[model samples]
Target: MKYLLFLSCLVISITNLYPASAHKVEVSGDVGGTLHIEPNDNPRAGEPSQAWFALTRRGGRVIPLSQCNCELAVYAQPYAAGEPPLLEPQLEPVSAERYKGIPGAEVVFPKPGIYELQLNGKPVSGARFKPFEFKFEVTVAGGSTQNSRNLRDVNGDLVEGESQKLPTWAIALPILGFIGILVVVLQNMRRSGE
Candidate 1:
């Protein structure tokens, strides 16, 4: 009987050892015409800057400013595992992509890793300005931002999206209850026999 209780506790402990990783967000879209990025240099303060991209005639001509609240936003993450990247903005617009960032936004690639840029605009129907998006990669110098991507896992390995299951407390309580029930039933049977 004691051995059963001990075995249950051991099982619960082994199950609850590791931490879990959070779910990652993914953003993707189409790159219509010439995707223009300006200067393509490290950003400096008090500098006039801009970025933009053109759409092919097939995907529709220039995205009208009025039709779509044409605005650009950028994101960056590690290349190996698809995860939610960080966001940075000076006021609203970034001046990297030719200020052409008007139709699509310019993303600042601080770190030297694979990054994604999203050209977000108000949704449009048929002849109107259809929503557009595209994902691209950029490399930055090492240690660019305060928060960097930690993709590696335990045992000094790069274990992305891999997390351990079940916390110790969550597994232990159920087993303890089961053992208590078994002990009570066995004692009752012995008493009945006497």
Candidate 2:
């Protein structure tokens, strides 16, 4: 009984570390991947956010950047039929171990609202992999004081590219909170055992 209760609490705490809705998996016949957005997947306007794709082909084969010709586009809600994406983020290969060499980008939202990110890709050469497209909806919070300026790189280049590292405190707080919750749960278990 104690083991079951402990396991239940453990699972609950682990799951709370990230909201269930923040991560999304998209699959197509040719290729598929889960899109990851950093800073808890809730980006803020005017701030740089890291986004990447962990892609795989059929049979769970990893898709490296050199093998894919990919583009990523971000659009505001209520997307128009003939309009271009609000932002066409420049794609670079991420260095993350699990996502190493996968297409990734840094993006900044100009406003707080619902946004759509569309990822399209095909084999770099030959008939290696079929074309694939994946879409993800993101709800951004906060607002940007300077929308026009936020869309550019530091050198004033326009909407073609962007990471602010989170503070240590921001990282530490959640871990501390999780520890506090675990303590309380363990205390309760001890009392119940008595």
- lDDT value, residue 118 of candidate 1: 52
In model 2, which regions exceed 4 Å deviation? 1-18, 143-194
Candidate 1, residues 1-194, lDDT tens digits: the string is 66567656766655554434221222324325344444453322223224355543345344433344444445655434554446634323323323222343444554455455555555445435446555544333443222323566567775444344567877777677666766876777689779
Each candidate: RMSD:
16.0, 9.4
Name every residue pair that clashes in candidate 2.
106-162
**lDDT by residue for model 2 (153-187), tens:** 67877762123446787677767766776688778
TM per candidate: 0.37, 0.63
C-alpha RMSD of candidate 1: 16.0
Q: How well does candidate 2 score on lDDT at residue 22? A: 52
* Alpha-carbon deviation at 165 in model 2, angstroms: 22
Candidate 2, residue 151: Cα displacement in angstroms equals 24
